[model samples]
Target chain A: MSYRKAYLAAPLAALLPVQAAAQGIDETINTIFADYTGWYVSLIFADLPGTNFSWIALWLVVAALVFTFYFGAIQLRGFTHSIALVKGDYSDPDDAGEVSHFQALATALSGTVGLGNIAGVAVAVGIGGPGATFWMIVAGLFGMATKFTECTLGVKYRNEYPDGRVSGGPMYYMTKGFSERGLPGGKIFAILFCIFTILGALGGGNMFQANQAHAQLSGVLGEYPGWITGLLLAGVTFIVIVGGIKSIAQVTEKVVPFMGIFYVIVSVIILLMNFDMIGWAFGQIFMGAFTGLGVLGGFTGALIQGFRRAAFSNEAGIGSAAIAHSAVRTKEPVTEGYVALLEPFIDTVVICTMTALVIVITGVLNIDPETGLYVWNSEAGRISTEGEVAGVELTSAAYARAFSWFPAMLAIAVVLFAFSTMISWSYYGLKAWTYLLGEGAAKETTFKVIFCLFIIIGASANLGPVIDFSDAMLFSMAVVNVIALYFLMPIVKRELESYVSRLRSGEIKRFKS
Target chain B: MSSEVFVVAYEGAQDDPGVLGYAMQRAAVEGATLLLVHVLEWSPYSFLTPEELEERHGRRAKEIERARSDVTGPALDKVKAAGIEAECVIRYGNVVELVVEEAGKAGAGMIFVGRSGSQSVAARVFGSVPMGLAQISPVPLVIVP
Candidate 1:
């Protein structure tokens, strides 16, 4: 073996013994914990049957669909109103809130519109084939309805501090809404949502953002000790995030638009460069989506892969965006709700489509005719034993092949995208933390410090299992948020009617300054 | 002896503004003075001189006068027919701080301000200003939504 291979093998070999030792301890601890909590574990685990559909995912989809139906497909009916909200057509400076509608959307977009669009889409296409993109778009469309409902609830239940500051999100809505409805276990559900949101803010929001940033930095800068990137990101994040949402919004309004436009422009260039293959590439997507082509275990597996990745990317039903959207400066909850609908459309429909097209057009994969397993291109010098290329590397390679020096540019974009995402998520997590711990300087400082530390942790360590668990926790939040929205649909309906009446009667138009 | 109350009216929203102007005119009719304070919130950073600042505040004051005319025009004419005296005052600073200070300066017993509604629906449901003013203001604040 070459020296590089020998070097790579050493640490992995060294880990074996450590893993074995740790496994022994883990097994013992598991035995003790399992004995102590046997019934609880059984109850939780028993819910999961190894079926094709994930019960959690299914529940989320059903919730999203039901919300879409219950709200009279407000996502569709309110599309024009959403546009007006973004345009600030109805905006008044004297309104009781912080930030503009556009700023709120951008802030929320920055949180969801990160590496998941790039790497997550790549993984989906890689595993589920092209048809998955269709399902993802469908899911995203339904997700807009979910976003609308939850964001409305977020604004509805928000608490404004004495200093004219705002505090909101699923935690407030879940508890306050439920209590108003006189539901039992409202407080418990609220507490649970808070706990899950905080965990999500840490795992998905904080660590995942850090991990992606570190990856892009390492990829571009050629692995010059992970802590260097970690420290730099942590410091920059601390400065920006210390100022809170106002600071975060100001930055995102600039960053999200620039980065989003830059990526879209690059994707357009790549598509134009390979303009002829666009037809064939789309064909493969359609064909692979349904037939599964050579993929092992047939169409079912591909469908699962696509749905999972799409859900991960858009976070439509997850309700995390509602936390960001609640701070909008509108009097009409449905107005912000209308604005929230644009999130999934922008995130999933526009951005994810760009990613899926790029990966498909690149033609990197060689599928087995019968089994559909990807064939290694050993002679092409791009194949690795890792079974799959990392999402960032795959995207980088695609760009590099398209424009020769483009990988370096992509690496820079990735880092910026990831860093922006981390800062936004840090805010989300901190807000969630404040909701749970109360708004003290010490608690706030502690959350920020811990969040920053995770940048280093995510950069320096493997986060495979951590990200998986984090993802699960994030989806679990959707469960609670959607349930609350369902019970509170009547309130949303009332608000919708009132807003529409005002709009139709020209009450909104007649208001003079 | 009765205490005086000041009502601040925005340029538009006729129904509410009319009622507010009528109320203020009635308060003056009842032998209590009415002071209408409007602050431009035009920052010093936006202008070259205190003169320029005054100019901007003047224009805003005229706009407030137009609003005052609309409110106290036909409505207050009727109130004057019923015998009420009303005055309008304009100042500059932060809206909340100026509103509070002017109320104190005028020695007003109570302040009546109209809620402009929120720029977005979220702001309305959460009740931002009412929640905020309730926390700090020394005097009672009644927010009309």
Candidate 2:
């Protein structure tokens, strides 16, 4: 039977699942998820009729490019001011209650900078060869303008409560922005966005993070029950989310930055150790971008992998960062937009590029001396690696070649990254939950409990279909949010123009030199 | 009354009270107002959790209120009871810099600060508040142990 038909018959088929019991509960759950949700996953990820390029990736890339041209490349023009804003050079002391531009950017970074940097980049480079890094950086640069537009609208249209709380995101902008323009379907779009956000939160945000954490732990500590890692992670998350324990969040917040710095330092050390190879790595990346370096589908394959990973990694048009940046304490909405643009630059341009460089410089991928092309393994369907590893493991192997202790440290970092990502996504999901269900303790707690439970399920099972479905839900958010951005770009443009003129006239005073 | 003011670098109730007493005596002797400055150490570049970000505004307001009512307010009352005119300034930033800036703005003849009792290596190696003020304070600095 078809997967769609399987989903419909799941309830009745639930009685017939005893056959897979000998394979363990994880296997059984995986089978069920594959059977029931496979159709939805296939639909969301379905490529163009003749091409391997995902329409969702194209949707995001096109929107980013559109924003780039429309804003006069604000990401480049306003780059200096964005740095100044983040440095608190223009911040007014009176605006003390709002989150500082730096804090907002850091918080948003913690959310997007997790597994995507470590694992996702490896996947792109592994399949697309070095050339994928070029497209990834390009996508990241264009995505900055998209972040500028959405975050500007996010702050402008945010809902400020009497008690100093804020609620914003694609949902708010879609509803308020659409209605303000006298457009129909504002509320409908908002509701749809929230639904997608909630699903995306539970699946990609919570479950996928939990699964990866479990994988990392098992990879290092030896195989144990996945539920043990899940329970531990869930219990810790539950305390933070339900009990309002700030200590874990505080610790993670502090460590995540140090972890990022440490990761960069190690990568730099490895790069320096292979200092002479830097130029060669760049050559591989550039040549691979245009010629695919002997990868499958050649040029198109490299471009697709690079763009897909970057779009997934940085989440420029996904509208999640908008929610986080919306809380910045600034009277000038455009200022936050300037600051938000840095998110993609830091996430994709810097961190992801670092990963790709390390992979290439370490000589992890085999290259045939005759053709000077990456030795693609037909059986594995990707470039052959030094350790026959993939994803984060490949990254670990590359670094471990330099430092034997690197993998253990990476394991800890992976857990921390996953935990922090989960916390940030929980907030995003909670905001969407409150928006849809009308905000009460009981309703909010209901969502939080379910979220924590999904952590257990995610860690315990190899639910590929579930992850794919949630990933689709996450990308689907960009679809609805980007459509509204097209309508709302004029508002952002007006705000930007007014702010710039005032700034030029010295009507907006600088608080710091 | 003289136009001169003495800027007292108040840390908190946990700080040594000798700075406030010394500043008050000098202010009374010179017939100048005591400018008690309290700074809550804050950096905009610091990392914050999502919950903290959401409640930062409320927490900041509450922090200002608590500093006013619990720390600076009582110091002002003590100065007023001593028959010395006094006011207070509370802000959030680097302590040494803000205190020095407040002294400059108040055009104080002298700045008073308590000796930092921190024996931590970071304090000794990096310099303490008193050390910082000693290096940068435009006016005369009084370190009351």
lDDT of 1 by residue, A264-353 (tens): 898999999899998877776677667765554346556666666667777776777777777665677888889988998898888888
Looking at model 2, the pairs that clash are A131-A289
| Poorly placed runs, candidate 1 (over 4 Å) | A1-50, A93-98, A242-253, A368-388, A510-513, B1-145
Tens digits of per-residue lDDT for model 2, B1-145: 2578889899877553688877777777788888889988888888988778877877788889999999989888888988888889888888898888888888888999999888999998999999999999999999999
Please give the TM-score of chain B in predicted model 2: 0.95
- What DockQ would you assign to candidate 1? 0.03
Docking class of 2: medium
- Give a tens-digit lDDT track for model 2, residues A1-513: 445435544553443454245237777667876777677677767788898877777888899999999999998999999999998889997574458999999999999898888887887898899999999999999999999999999999998877777666888889899998999998888888888888788877887778777776666665555666788999999999998888999999989988988998898888899999999999999999999989998998898889878877898888999899888888889999999999999999999999999999988899999999899988877899996777777888888888978987998998999899999999999998988898899998998899898888778776345446557778878888888899899999999999999999999999999
DockQ of each: 0.03, 0.60
Top of the candidates by lDDT? 2
Instruction: Tell me each candidate's i-RMS in Å.
Output: 13.7, 1.5
Query: How well does candidate 1 match the true structure in TM-score terms?
Result: 0.69
